[model samples]
Target chain A: MNAVEAVAKPAASKEKRRTFDVLEALIYLFAVMMLILIVYPIYFIVIASFSDPAAVAGGRMWVLPMGFTLDGYQELLKHSNIWIGYKNTILYTVIGTLISLAVNVSAAYALSRKDLAGRKAITLFFIFTMFFNGGLIPTFLTIRDFHLYDTFLVMVLPFSVAVFNIIVARTFFQSSIPGDLWEAAQLDGCGNLKYYVQIVLPLSKAVLSVLALWTAVGYWNSYFNALIYLKDQDLYPLQLILRNILITNQMQSSMGTGEAAVIAMRLANLMRYSVIIVSTLPIMCMYPFVQKYFNQGVMIGAVK
Target chain B: MSQSNAGMLHTLGRIRKNWGLYLLLLPAAVLLLLFAYIPMYGVLIAFKDYSPATGILESPWAGFNYFEKFFNSYQFDITIKNTLVISLYSIATFPIPIMLALMINQMRANRFKQVFQTVTYMPHFISTVVMVGLILILLSPGNGLLGNLFRLFGAEAPNLIGSAGMFSSLYVWTDVWQHAGWDSIIYIAALSAVDPSLYEAAKVDGASRWQRIRYIDMPMLLPTAITLLILRIGGLLGVGFEKVYLMQNNLNISSSEVIATYVYKIGLLSSQYSFSSAINLFNTVINFILLILVNQAAKKYSENSLW
Candidate 1:
């Protein structure tokens, strides 16, 4: 290459790099602004939860907690229903997730085996539910008819068959698990049941954990079932209890009058922030670690 | 005849061989039959005058009476209009995640990209109950953060949560905020699949970054975008019940009352089982038909479809 050509190429590339640098900077600026838009509200809530109710309402608790206090948390913890809600929610999430994983994973593994009979027909049965369903009232009636209404079993048993979970797990099994392993296991005198339990599941930890976390989070957040089916307060989950405190109770408090009204409103406001923190902090804390596995599951599902 | 008999025998042999797999599938099959299929059968109540004491089977037939009632009712137009408006509004903002993914993919700083993604996805894990609660607390005109901001400027905060005009915006925008980062994952996956050599080739050819993104990334993401768009369109009428129900009040009821909440009120709250079932059945049918139409259209016009 001649000197003039070499000089021209380097100059041209330099201009390109300059443009890229400017564009990259703009992208970063936009991302950081978006990040702050999301994170600031959460940060404000944390500070406001600790700040005195009057200071928070008076607009003094901006950058940091002004006249910091723990009355909100103290009040929230004192509410007896919250404890019951927490116990019920933990029980439901653990038991419901176990049931969900058991049914979904087994069905997915069965459907994933190419050697399985009538696979296409069975798969279509599950997929059809994704397109259409019985809607709300009928399902509620079905639950009631089965005597699952207003029971602990109602929270964990009836709604465990998630077709989307089945599809995702099936996709994972089909793509990630080797057919060669099944053949080798069969040669080693392993039956289908033993092979799945021993060989397949052990190798599928990433997908299993992903499914587990998703189901657990789902169960933790679910309240509509409780809202519609259960009348018994004893079986109410955290989301239902939180809803009563955060939304329903706020209305009742606002309708009151005089000094009591003002006090009730202030306490209600304080307790809301605390309740949010209590309900979501566990999930948020676990989110960063479980995020990659979720992405992995999504990637596997998307390959379809 | 002999060949067909042999084929039947082969199928039976496969079934016999896979009895263990069949056993594994039994739990899910039974659950779906109980929860999914039985409810589907119970949907016959829409065509019958369902009395709880008499049961669905013994309830007298109502035929098209409930369907006609729903069609004539004022809520019919209101709920359909509200559902479509909110759904279309959400669909219009569909490009936001694609844009977010493209921006994140363009970032040369890996550390910043990872951090940005982590922070953004955090909001999605916030339960619907907590999310609406946050909306209420932060938007309360009497003493929320927005109220404090307004006070800083010597003004009162607007009644955002109670305004009918603001309801759809509140629902759609908050939904976007919570989900856009999570939704961008699929596009990000698609972008990562683009051959690195393609980027290198464009760079060596002296293409600018904008040009590279336009030529390389956008095209790669189109199929996934179309697929997701189809899926969204399929579920257009199926707006969520929880958030809208929680956010609702006397003030915003005109705008916020969609089909799901309407059915809940009429069926469970009012004890008009047959009428509510009709409305719900209508909604589900529309959703199913729309999905099929969109999937077919996509398959015909392009290469992407759910099937």
Candidate 2:
């Protein structure tokens, strides 16, 4: 009886191992499928952008660039407005990120302090806005009333200090920066401002970088504000400008007729792919450097 | 009453002692007041027969007239239904990320896991316009990648972008594609935090891998999942404006027209401020109530809640 039980146990263990192997294989298959789904479109865009427009339109460009040419990129770059859009976008991103970080970090610091007066009420006040706000028309009117309708300040000022960022920053400060450090600073005759700027800010580099990257990315990608506020063509950010180019190309290709129409359609298809690559290239390039920090930052902010 | 008075005085004294902290908070407070709070006052326009010339303050009080109008309008039913459909579609796809995270966690190779994560997360950084453009290019019937694939199969390529019925699927699936990896980060973090001893114990008990995952890992992930689910439901009606707007065309406008885009059109394009404001107010109030209800439900059911 003991010998028979032993043999049965070995057979069962072998069956379990085979099931586990199959399960592992299934998981790998799913992961690979998801990877392809997420990546193929972006890759197709890259190769298509470089491929000859005629080949791309004819559906011959697959897996690799067919009749590779730089005409699409050349056409995009030849439009001088793309460069201005780049410059404007960069300026908005930098200036807006600085302002956002300054306003949000300071506010978060104050809120993070347990002894601050009316902190609960202040926090609620800030959070209430996240759930409710004036609709589009009223916000637009308010911007116009402030005399910031088409000005560069309109891009940076009104939208600074995101409530979500402030909350995350406040949470980071509370959890990470020790109360003992504050006490130690106080013992050294460090005032609140001095302690915040000298001790706390220096210690809070992780949260600061997180906030900076988030704010910069938001500002860089923003188009709605420019779409509504900036009427001046010269002041258009990269996104709004790119949107226009893409839309106009679509309209031109779809609406036109005859030989000129065919040519326009071909160029538009080329421009469409190139514009996507050009607009996204900078952000994509910056992403890898910040990706590790970003994962850590999001986890730290999200977990609590 | 005396205890409350004392508490108030204590807070005031603390504030006086930490005046510099108050100074630190001032700039953000002022910005919040001007942008967030002040715009809330503009919600009053919904209650008025607002006119641009008379301004928001001087506009004649109409007392639910705009609200009644919005409720009675033809656009009301379509927008609300469209919004709910799209949002529920999104909610349906929420579990995809959790499942993906669990699968990724099962990988034996650390290097492969990292590569999978990095590649999948890349799409989240793509701007809305670029994302929409990519979608269009890939789905374009005449010359798209999908079209080419369809041709390979000896089938006609359907106009996915132009089909109203296909709008929700495209929006939801593309959203899953872009965000599944990024959203799975929290779940991955939660999975890693589960005790290693539990897995060893389960192994000793002769538990299969699936059984271990079901009994041990899943239970550990529940609190985080519940918390995230509650938050997602709270913002369910606040369907992202930019992506929907970019994806909208005359072809699929029937399915694509959400409260946000409708508000933009009436409020800004056609200059029907009061009507759009009323529509927006309805949307926000419903969202707020949904948030509260979900938060309460979460608190009652589980230890995890937003409040």
Candidate 3:
């Protein structure tokens, strides 16, 4: 989309432009097909989320909500765990972003410095971990070892510094921060600490915001660690809770609809779509605001 | 001051100067060292009969034993074959994004185009579990919209989700539809960076829009495209696991059993930790070799590589 807007230079001679009429029509046809392919399923899911659970299962849903209802949302809301999940997700994303951004920026700044001791070694050390790591059992054991296995710390602490996020932050610091500023800071007896906190952090807002958003999203969407490490229901994030609901729905749907449990399970299955929407809605709302930065500021900031 | 004393003082002064920054970096450093690096050391379990009761220290030495077991496992050859082939299928479909970006680039900059682009990118963010659910709901043989549509056209509609032959193609194509637009963000950025002055010059020389794009946009995108291609190659084996896992049933597990799913079955479900670790270790080794080779190739070809 940005591609079309950015590269728009109106062509000469509408006739010449329309000369490849067959190909133009063909491309438009294919593009429309692709658009529908991408859009319709998700649109249907959203519609299904509001449809009467029984009607939807009877294969009656399409573009519009059938037997219109918000009962799925109501049912999902009644479960207090959903709110707990939302609270945990929000807390994790917000706090995790701050912790990660603080650590990543400073590490990136240190790694970006020309005169910093062992800068190359530090960068290499960080990058080395990206390509190889121990499998799940050992990592799970480590979480157990730290006694962080079921706590919220299991979700946030271990993944605080994503290597890619660090690299992007480091790249920005290297080019955007300007070596002359550092040199001048040193000359003015402004210590590295003051320069980083006072000057660098202030100047680094755009990329910092982008990294913060990425970290927040990572924390938001993460579930596998929660699945493995978390035993307690209270600690389950939105995704984990949603997965549980989905599995229960599957089991319910599989029992072939005669029993009272099956009827409730069918309601549970309808709630699956609603739960998905609920879990993703918070982050999606936050995304457009962060995404605007990615569209404009981050590109300029990214390239130094 | 004496030379050695001054050198020692310089080292200490440097450390003192950067102490605050070190303090800032300290938490992440400790986490990565403990969580990420320590696990690589724990890869030693592949060579031992590991027990959670005894821990890494007291685990009996097995020395090439798990790898031997994995190599001899009934599913070994098929898992490798399946993983590589599915990834190869993914690689083939990669250029669809380039084409989509180019097509979108050619469209007139209108509200319709913006809506179209937004629509395309939206699917990329739908959670994988939901995506598989959507696929299952939409493609069910007897009653799904598509299947029912096919029956109306006087044809027998097969159960797509149940078909092993359709699995990889369905996985790859669905991935393409979900991701192609979002992935085009960088290429779009690259396209925007193309010098419009070049297009103006081309127009003055009687060049067509197609010719101008062929000349300017394609060359501009090459660097970005090459960089992304290298990264994709580096990540060839590490396909996202959730969707495949969700999509699989007993009927289709034959083709759907890639290295990741196989590893999960072996480690998580079967508790063959050491053997699965060996398999994953092997996967990482292959990925490492590809990253280096592809990074070098990108550097050679386009002067754009991740390293």
Best by DockQ: 1
Candidate 3 lDDT over B237-259, as tens digits, reads 88767777777877888888888
Lowest lDDT block of 10, candidate 2 chain B: B128-137
* lDDT per residue as tens, model 1, A16-89: 55666777888888898999899999999999889889999888888898888898999987898998999999
Q: What is residue A244's positional error in candidate 3, in angstroms?
A: 2.7
What digit string (tens of lDDT, one per residue) describes model 3 on residues A201-272?
A: 999888888887767766787677776788889888777776666642453465565678667765766677
Interface RMSD of each: 0.8, 1.2, 2.6
CA error at residue A38 for candidate 3, angstroms = 2.2
How accurate locally is residue A119 in candidate 3, as Cα lDDT from 0 to 100?
71
lDDT of 2 by residue, A60-176 (tens): 888999998888888887889988999999999999999999999999999999988788899999898888888787788888888999999999988896989898988999999
By the TM-score metric, which is better: model 1 or model 3? 1
Q: Which parts of model 1 are misplaced by more than 4 Å?
A: A1-19
RMSD to the native, candidate 1?
A: 3.1
RMSD (Cα, Å) of model 2: 4.2
Global lDDT of model 3? 0.76
